[model samples]
Target chain A: MSQHYRTLTANSSSYFVLVLALTALALFGLAAAHYMESEGHWITGMNNQIVWGLPHVFAISLILSASGALNVASMASLFGKTEYSAWSRFSGLLAISLLMGGLLVLVLDLGRPDRLIVAITHYNFKSIFAWNIFLYTGFIVLVAIYLWFLFERKMNQYVKVAGLFAFGWRFILTAGTGSIFGFIVARQFYHSAMMIPLFIVLSLSLGTSVFILVTQIVGRLSGSFMKQEISFSLLRLLGLLLALEGFLICAFYLTGLYSAARYDVVLFVLINGGIYTFLFWAGQIVIGTVVPLGLIFLAKAQLNSSIRLVSATVSKMIGSFCLLYVMVIAGQSYPQLMFPGKQIRSTFFDGVVVHYAPSWPELALGMGGVAVVGIIILVVTRVLPFLPVEEQRAQSSQ
Target chain B: MSGSSENLGSVDLKRRKFMVTMVASMAGAGFNLVELAMAKTSLEAESKLVRWGLLIDTEKCGVGCNACVSACNTEHNLEDHGRPETDAQWIRKLDLVDEQTSHVHSLPMLCQHCEHPPCVDVCPTGASFRRDDGIVLVDKHTCIGCRYCMIACPYKARSFIHENLTNQRSWSPRGKGVVESCTFCTHRVDTGRIPACVEACHAEGGGAMTFGDMVNPESEISHRLKSEPSRQIREDLKLNTGVRYQNV
Candidate 1:
């Protein structure tokens, strides 16, 4: 069946309000970043030990989600799922915007954001960070080209090849992101090959959830409805991806438990690690994985579709944050075991669990990134024919 | 007999003339023999043959000695920001107690100056680099303050400059939003002086630190390393660190 697409009229006052609100939020985030830069990171929760904190969680999640968001386009073009092609343009747009938001957060959180030009110009081939700089930029370029092919009628034939390339690049991009943690030989929490797959599956799960929520909101705004068949299929896909994410998380912990060297940290995170432990069991496993899975499968016959969708997506998003909090923050919270059999004490808080309480500025900066993504999606859908319109509506309008 | 005596006298006169010529040339060049040797040694500091290293006898390191730490601060002019957790600690004293035995040992920890330094390997900008003379240093000009090097260091040897720095010593240039660590007092080392921490340790602390060329067999560091039992903190990483420790 041929798919129809439509753009929002954008004349509504609510549209302007949303635009204004998102712009304000984005500005607030920028202001927060400026405050941190001027006042220094000491004002934030991060210390010398806990170098990466809340902003990293937001940035990494968004970046990981960006790659996952592209799965729709990849499915339609690369996997020959023609039904998914209708939503591919929207998917591509979301992917780029999400990446932009993530990259912005990562850059701003840097000690010297002004030297971004140096990061671009200078290349340390050995460094995974340097590699990611290329991977991230190349992803945007490739996705843009893919979107171009999807938008232009004459170039539609080459969309498949572009989709294939984008799919491969996203995989590599996620791996590069994962390797940023995995390559660190110093820390016990990371430095595993498992990070690559874990992050890849997480992106798939989180990105799909974002896609569903945003599409639903866009549908309400545009007065377009998705066919029940398509909605159910996406839900099933989400359930499957969530299961994969859950499985990987279990495997990651089990592997860590198996290693005597990593056992202490694993125990710390799982049992005694106060916030980290609670987040792992309650936030990540139950809310992120278990509840979402239950809502999709167990409650399918009993609950309303909108309730189920909202509940599962929201749970997944919350769970993702919790997991990242544990991964990024808790990972560093456990001190590096520099001396194997010796307990160390120093003025620098060595051999001690470093506690980090993220300040307001950190939260603002993170939320700013989220708002930027929101604004990008809202504006693009209004200006461009991104929202998928129903066949009947398409016929009636024309 | 008269001719033979005359020949002997000529030979003696020739020998005296040669000795005088040598002394006159040395004086003309304005360099005493000792000063010439010192200049050659100074030039060799830039060469890879001179691997600067430190050997710390943890046994001799006093438990409460803050001399080395204070000296490093004074040397670098690391301002007291009132936040010790976020301050730059180029070198700090570590008190280690064996988990099984509960025997306590004290020693100072700083940048290990590894042969295959992970910080240099992971640095995106090549700002965290190891000099030819086996000293690892962060180039202030190129360091974009990513702090990946800090994360990569196993010893937790690095610190990020948390706030905007002022009143920094001209020799030790520090700024905000950049990573800094123990430079092994490269400024002093360049001018034929040991690191302030080593000097202070010798003068006020336990005299535990011995600084010398690791490559030179005749150097005290090389001799101690050979004669005494010294080991790197994380020898399993095979980083070949320039810093070595004795006892527990």
Candidate 2:
């Protein structure tokens, strides 16, 4: 019992250190945002052609993460998966945190953050962005209430019903996110009907991986064991989902190439030819998906205890990072207009017809948003009995 | 049966008389307003023909003289910044190349004054709107610095004044943070003067741009369209743009 307490203390210290680092980074970002607002969007690297930059990418990633987290929590609570019940509360808390973080980044990205309320009041029913405002707000509220019921209140049949409602709505909310890009017929790369389903699948994979990583890290710190059955099941689920995601990405590129859409094909070439290609193929694919799957397979095949745990932990982290990177690139790479003859050349950056590199200030604000997520997760874990306290005690005594 | 037939006849007669009176009165009112408005302008055309549009010949547009650009800046009081992309340009010449074939083509680009303008549709405050005469304009008074119009515009004709601009007339509404685009030189059109760009193009030998009332059968723009083949940019979009290009 003393050894377990010591382990918890050490883990808490590390989490605290991480939280502190993220907070400092966020403050720097806030300062940059203030300066940007005082001045204008001109302070950033964005130009006429590349109006959106890194902040937009980060915001989209956060939204994806939030949606994904909600999916995992729903699988346990709404689907009546008793094995996943232990991690449901933590997942719910993370979902709300990521959603809030996503919204913050999105608001900061806007040239006129002061006019945010106007976006809500003035709705274009035809525009997907207008719908997203409502969907995202509703999703956050549902998740918050769901988490509250799990952690603060006694879990009841009503809570399960609410969980089911949240789980169902999140799919539409994520679909709405995809439609924001998918509806633009002008952009050939994003005009496909497959984007909505792709977003949902990616959200599931990313959401599950993040939940797993957070659980493992927290368990390791507190010297509490997550049920081995739940951990293995999640790992296996993630492996299969990732494998499908990888296959779909290949099919997407092949169709783009075969279609011979000149401007649209350029997006693929830019990602594959430049620094982004390495990030895509190496960081996103190999480190994030392939190696992680291999490690999980080895662990399941009765590999050494130390190796299995280390690989599982590494795999989760890499998967989360990969999911984030893919979303960012996808949002940024596609130009505003994708018509073949009607191309507007950008003059903002040199050495290309049109180029986009996120400014330092944008990056800082994005990092700050990431920090906010960490802080929220940390606070929630501390206040609520995120772990099954009774189960832990019984196991320790045995 | 006879009584009912007689009643129906009386009702039909009354309706016909009412319709005639209403049509006559509306036409009278419309004519009076037009006369009153035209009386205020000294250079008003005798025929009351106004709201000029341009027919640009993309093939004949020379890359040499930027006379249209210079005239637009002088008339609009636009800053003489070297970077035309950042600075406002009511009219710009673009050199386009076919990505597959490397075939190059040059065309002078500006606002198309689309029949169904996306910018006007998306404006939350009705800052951007089309006038009755079919010219699209932005009222800077109601603009709230939100660049929704910029994103909605397919032609990318709109520009936002990012910094504080001076030398604007005290009565003039356009300023910083508001969107501005080519108005087809509405002020000059109201006074029966050709737009600065059209006049400049004419000075360089009327081969590039021809301006006149599109509705007038005898107008130069109408004559050019009849005599030569012309095409609108992004015709597939079905925006029904006022601006036409020749020899694309």
Candidate 3:
């Protein structure tokens, strides 16, 4: 609870080069967004049929994980876990940067990105998309306030209230993100109320996975380590959350498949849907759910070992990305049913499984978001104290 | 007492005016509301009083005939630039084959212009909106091109302009980086003329499409729907589409 934090000197050539590289990547993303905005979305692989592509996948995953990142702060302040309070500031910082990264991608992907102000000014209470604009903005502000409370010793008492607000806000934010797809009645795959909970579980697992990775990086860079016991506890919690997420996904898939109306979609997702099937089973089921579960469920003797922690963390990270990719991309590629009793043939690719191969620009922009987040973290950690409490070192010391 | 009495007099006058309006409306209730409106103003403005709709007799739609699609393309200045995947299809014949019986039914699919449009419901900027006369449209000025409406549309009727567009019709203003769909030939419909597709169908394809006001029971589409038993595509969604199909 009495942890004293300090900023990194970040004087090493390698560290400077890493920051420079990430900044370049972020700038490249901005350039790509500008090019697409000026030229058209046709430059990207997104067409009239598969309107959303890699941009959406990356954006949603980042945003959901951003909300999850705040779990550390929430547990610390909101749930009265004083030990985690040491890391709450770091959580708040990561959460803000992640949200900014995700939001930049989403805004740039808009067909009329120039008229972004219109989106904010207009109110469509019925639309989940409209609600999300507020949710996302509210989260950033809440994170800022939570971090402020952490930094300002006098206002530490209000940290709990801010964390509570942030906790509730993020719940709605992630739920709204899921509902964007779920409330879509036109599609065979989405429209279940259960998607809300499914996404929440997804956010928790992915969030924790990202947190574990950040913690490791923080420990390495700052030379102040998270206690072995705390790391173990966090990993175990991640494993439990992943298991819950796995159950929810399975239950959701089965429930959706059971409906006669959705039988075709189920077949497409599980059987005939080529890339979609691969993504669902191989990418999501095996890599994401299974590997993490396997790593986390290791025997107590192995679990206590440092090697086990690193392996588990790495697998969990891979798993989160895989599941999110499947959830976003494959979920969209499947054809929507316009006619229940009839097979359709059309030039507009109606009533057919659509394939989405994201072009170079799309992939660049997607990774740009990650680079932006990384750059922010790097710069912030160097300028401000975001690491665990350690002996203060002057800016001259590397 | 005098001030109170004057106030009572104004209140009495308001009540008297309300009674007069109520009595007048009640009297005109015997006549069609559209007819009674002749006293107020000319029907020159396309009033929401009429809900325009289309009744398509799918049985009469000729196989391999793309008269309607061709007409829609020309009418809206929708050019095909060798990219069928990205081009906007204002209307196209959906060649539907019954999976079990192998029975085939072909019907032109376009924007349904539902009474409760999902596109309108999901648009973040409220740009996707339904006109009072039952025509759904996107206000390009306000549309941020987010394409959430496309995600919400049940019929897959919407299209996004993937490439930079040029040579657009003055009547149908379109541009790149914005979502667009069939406006049901609003320019022609506003002028009290049938949609280009309906005219095309009557001329070249087949006498399959009937366009008129669904709100008017005496209108051809209204009468046809009532007599022939037509159905809206995805009727389960309860969108109450302005477009209907018969003998599918």
Candidate 4:
């Protein structure tokens, strides 16, 4: 019976309420997307200067985290962490669900959402965006295969090969996502080779943090308990990855500031560029980087106690959100340089910072992407034998 | 009998020579006809023979000259819609001041139409493309409206049509969500006519802009380019833009 994992069984009333709430959130997101399509982009905060808006922030965050979710499974199978073997199926399932949620936001936000067929049919092979469509879809397929390898007892020996392939596939897939911005030669906030590695590490940290939060929440809901050893070990790894994320970000800025052409953007992001500066320092750094890192290591210092695990999870989630917000939205708000040294003036607001406040509908849509992930997790756990069978006891029967 | 046989042989040889020469001439005529047809098609089709470029003499450009802007608006029917904040600007005047010397100059800026355009490179659907003639344009039909091209454009030369577009110019069709920019007036160029902005600048004032074939070396723009030194905006990127500015 391959350890006899079971689908969760909840009270009908609670299940109904949960499904209904998730359905409502998903519907709201769909409605918002429809409105945006009908009303035109003028309704959104996005303009000529700031082409991407909250949608990108939401979608990219989910997408990156999806790739991150695979790491736990990869650890168990590929790296031979047998104890992690329990949560392995759940991790693969989480990755696919997160990825689909993220893709929903992206597709809905497209200017010609109607022309999605065109994006699929007609591709510029040179484009990173084109490469991403394949990367994203391929990721789903690969994860499914990995999950199958775990589910079928006879196919279990293929786990190592499948996990290894899946791990490498996700690394390249995420790098392709980062390279979407990295290839831009015009924008100061982008075009760094560091973005590729940054995305890879960011995906690991954010995805792992998300996986931890989801694991705990699902465990509480399903009345199952993850071993204390597994929980704390994952938390410690999260802390280390978060620290690595901060380090890589510093290296990115350091290299950028060295070049005069890129320095204006760096200064704007960190110091003087009004709202952008606040977001970077306060939203991303103080909340996302500093506090999460502090909470994680502080939790670690307590001899890896389970009581501190909650604080660690909360902080990492906050950090992940803040960093993503800074990278996606705030980054776009900063102006692109036309003339490096010229005092630029224009009616078009050249060389001036653009203000972007996401409308309510946009916020709803972003939440929708998050809610979509939740609903997927709920439904998947209900149907698939994703959870580890803790006991062959009477508790599981209830 | 021997004399008659010799006579018969000579007649047969003459007939064979005649047949060979006749077929050879017919084949030569068919070859010439095919050559003519190919030549005609080549002449009729658009050629990349001469790269169309612009030479803007910023020295002659006057301050507060809205002529080019107005002419472009009329040509493309760019609706102000009383929302300057959101209205699309195919071309706009830039006021540039030298940081070191405090020197100021006014010049129009739009799509540079680089030989190597970042917009075209980033577009997932090859909607944003450069014509063989060096004019960069957006194919609204194919555009999924991703707007990555807008982010990639260093000059901020692209604009997204935010409002549901109405009364779009027959010559310049635009739609909401589609990214558009100065097409260098491709329709006008096709008909052997100058762009509305260029014509306005010349007919009215600022005689600052020159549009012609830079590849010809004999064209007026090519002559002016050779006579005086001009520089491209953000020349460091080496995009090889069709648009050039003189004296910054």
Candidate 5:
């Protein structure tokens, strides 16, 4: 049976309010970025010690999730899961929207946001960051073309090829993101080959969680429904991804714990680094990983599937943020090991774990990126027939 | 003396007049007399033959001697913003106490100017670069202030400018939102002078610092490095840092 999609009516008062709210938040975020740039980064909590702060955590999470958002579309086209084909168009749109949101944060957070043109024009092949610029833009273009193929009846023949290409590019995109930290040999926390796989899995977990949340919220608001089986299947996929994410995170820290050189940093994050330690165990490992896993696998029989799914996805989202916060911010906060077996002191914050408290503007800028994603999805669904509609159910609802 | 005067008087009048006229014109047009005297002008461009480096004898570096740091600040016009964490420190005094032995070592730490700089490797815009003379410098024009170089530098030698400023030195040319670090006093080095830190260390502190050409075997730095035991800070990375330390 041919699946049908429909444009959102967008006549509801609630939808209008949401669109207005998201737009306001996005604009506020832009204003925050402007203030930070005009006055200087000192207004923010970021110092020389922690160069990248909250903005990085938010930006990286969205970017990784963007790739993962396309997983449903990949499943339909690449893995031949026909049940998932209905969700493909929405998935493609969500992927692009999420990427645009993430890119906005990353670019605006730059010291010279005005030199964005320079970043685009210049190419440093050895730098993973340069490679990511290409990967990010290329993924958007490829996914758009894939979406085009899915939309046009005449172009249906080559959808698989486009899907395959996009699928491959997203892996590289996520790898490039992970390698941003992995390639930093100077830091005790990074410079491991395992960063690539860990990031890829993270993208999968975060992306799937986001897709599930969006799928349900949009479905309910648009007065459409999916087969409970399909919803259950998506939850199962997220559960598997979370398990993989947990395993990789453990392996990453365990390997570092084995090395005496990496022991201090590991101990700091896992045990006694205060806020960082708490975020890792309570926010990242327990809430982000284990709780979600338990809720999905164990609580499924007793709880409503929708409630279980939402709780798990929301928990995972919180956990993902914690994980990134600990990884990016805490990773830099730890002092560089200049002298291996000596206590070194300097005015430049050497030999001490630097303190960073995210300023208001930084928080505003990060939240704004999330808002941008929401506004994009809201506007796009209204203008275009991106929403999946079950034909029989649509007729019954009308 | 009379015979020498008679020989000088016998010299061609026109040649002497032409030489005087040329020197006066060049001087009027803002020529550096020092550059002329050195014979190898700055316009000749830096050469690979001259690898500028420093050798610091940590044993001679006295505790609480802020002369080197003070000189570096004065030279670079590094103003104190009262926020040490965010302030631009071109050079700072470092105190290292052995965990096992309790022996304290005091030294001044700054950019090492590595032969293969990680900052240059990781710079997305090619802003961070190493000159032919082995003086690593950041071309601020291309620096997006990404701080990747700051992350890549093992010594934590780089500083990101965090606030707006006025009265920046014409020679230094620093601004907010860009990364800066020890340039090995490139402005002074280009004009045939030692770095401010080294000069101050020699004159006011413990005479711990030596600045010279590492490539020149006849130079004091090369002689000292070959004759005595000197080591790079992180030898395992094999960055081949131009700066070396002795008796740490």
Candidate 6:
């Protein structure tokens, strides 16, 4: 056995602790899911006005992350870029995990989660959300098949083709998910034609960052020496994407602020007034994007050292978290009406303005989904050859 | 022998063409018959014309009384008066204003009962549906409480009961996690009685609230529309709302 493998196997206590923590989280998530099912959507803080809540935000995040992971695989296989191939298996696993997590969050968010199968079977082809169901299912299947071919069987051109398809389809799928909000012509905040493209770009950044962070953490825990160059390149790419996303976000807000529409004013309040303001400025922009970008840039300038590696990994995780936060708030902030000549003030609750907040049980269930994904990835990595064992063997032989 | 063979071939071809044409005509007739049968069955099933509707005249609406709102609550067994911010009002008197001139107008607003309701269009579970009689109602049994209907509604008429609600009588028939909205006092309308709000308004001698079938020319609502100068909340949107405001 390799020295690294020996070290990983020897650290039984840490592995046990991690397993216990993840298991506890999973159990909590299952309990929350059960409670939500029995109690109905009333368990969540979501009211009529604030219909979409934390679960929706988290689900969108998972989708973006899943898509981004596919991008990594695409670059490696289809683009004939060998640098990303090393992390392809890990990235593929993360994509599947994120998608599963997203689907769970969405199902739980449904008024009738049991009717999810009905949603898939009886599709409203005109509805973007209906199309998303098929896209997400297809994307998951493609990723699974590609992973099976890569890890279980020999790496062939066919697997690469499948990976390419998954990668390309994910972009369209993520854009379609964004179009759920985008196609709401009634909602001025989401009415802009740019939402689909914005979502695609945002997903690419968030998904890529998550892929890097997960792999780095896993590599550290499993005593696998992931190439520093590969990690750095990913961090650099993610930073660039984050910068572009930031620019778009700024442009979106500026356009809203200047527009002479009532909905625009409402959006402005959501962004600048109270909790959402802090969430946007601090959580989304500063901590999520700018700081992470700065960290990655500084680390890259300093070269491939331990500090650079740690900074890049941590920043990526934070950036991904921030992107999810923004998606959730942005999705719910806009009311679905043109209130120009109406007498209604459009408050959070009452009349047309129903109040909505995610309940504790709903939030716990969402968190539990994250835990389940982590556990799944951990188990899959252990049982299956997620990392290239052949590459390691070749290095040893050399 | 050659002549006999050619004649036989021609006869066979002609017979085949005639059979094909006959079958095609029969199939077309068969499809039309099936369509007619399906239409008849639908008509039989949906014979009951329950065109539930509401009419609000801003002219006679007493601004401070809010009797219509109170009556709706009493009849529907809704929670008592809540704070303006957290209130669940089926009927609301909106204080409208001209943004440029600072001119204010109080218009009582509720479910418009729109002809092309955006809410019904977006419902994923078909929980929010429009009746053949132009009444929009929710199926409590099928409602997963997704609240997509709430988001899609232009009037913002839909309200979600956030907490666990009980003791809700059949008159209202709302529970926790299901979206509730102004059903034009469907239970009352189903009987001979007008909506609670309309009755309350009439009792107050304001005559602002009118309840009748818009489709029926003989209906009081149609007569009022012809006699009185009334306007919809957002007439520009062209929703063909059942509820109309007069003297705003």
Best by TM-score: 5
Candidate order by DockQ, highest to lowest?
5, 1, 3, 4, 6, 2
* Pairs of colliding residues, candidate 1: none
**Docking quality class, candidate 3:** medium
Candidate 1: segments with Cα more than 4 A from true spot: A391-398, B1-43
What is candidate 5's fraction of native contacts? Answer: 0.74
Q: What tens-digit string does per-residue lDDT give for candidate 2 at B173-244?
A: 456556788888876676556788888887863468888777778898888888889887667778777898
lDDT of 5 by residue, A1-398 (tens): 67778887757888888889998999999999999899989899999899999988899999999999999999999999998898899899999999999999999998888988878887677888888899999999999999999999999999999999999999999999999899887898986777899999999989999998987777666765555677778888999998888889989999999987678998999988999999999999899988999998888589877888889999999999999999998889998888889998888888999999999999899999999999988888888888767833843564
Error of 6 at B74 (Å): 3.3
Poorest 10 consecutive residues by lDDT, candidate 2 chain B: B39-48
Chain A TM-scores of each predicted structure, in the order given, are 0.97, 0.84, 0.94, 0.94, 0.98, 0.87
Clashing pairs in 2: A26-A368
Per-residue CA lDDT of candidate 5, range B89-116, in tens?
8888999999999898899899999999
The segments of candidate 5 whose C-alpha lies over 4 angstroms from its true place after superposition are: A391-398, B1-44
Scored by DockQ, the top model is 5
- Model 3 lDDT per residue over A192-255, tens place: 7778998888887788878878776666666656666677788889889988888898788888
Off by over 4 Å in 6: A1-11, A34-44, A114-123, A151-155, A266-271, A301-327, A330-359, A390-398, B1-53, B80-88, B97-104, B190-193, B223-230, B234-238
lDDT of 4 at A137: 94
Better of 5 and 6 by TM-score: 5
Can you give the lDDT of residue A338 in candidate 3? Answer: 79
lDDT of 3 at A147: 90
lDDT tens digits, residues A1-398, model 6? 32112123326677668877988987887787778666665556664556677877777777777888777788887888886776677778889898998888778766666666556555445546657778998999999888876765465547778887887888889888877776664456665556777888888887876777676667657756456566677777887888888788766667666666534544654554456556667777777777777787764565546566566556655655655555455445544443464434423332243334557777787787887788888777777666754334443453
Cα-based lDDT at residue A138, candidate 4 = 95
lDDT of 6 by residue, B1-248 (tens): 99999999999999999999999999999997865554434443223453545667666665466778778778887774343433456776666555677766555667888877767766665667777767788887767666767666667677776555566777577776667788887665554457888888889647777788776678888877888787776676677787877766
Per-candidate local distance difference test: 0.89, 0.67, 0.83, 0.84, 0.89, 0.69
Per candidate, native contacts kept equal 0.79, 0.04, 0.86, 0.82, 0.74, 0.28
Give the Cα error of residue B41 in candidate 3, in Å: 9.6
For the predicted complex of model 5, DockQ is 0.60
Q: DockQ (C-alpha) of model 6?
A: 0.17
**Pairs of residues at least 3 apart in sequence or in different chains that clash in candidate 5:** none
Error of 5 at A90 (Å): 1.0
DockQ values of all predictions: 0.57, 0.08, 0.55, 0.52, 0.60, 0.17
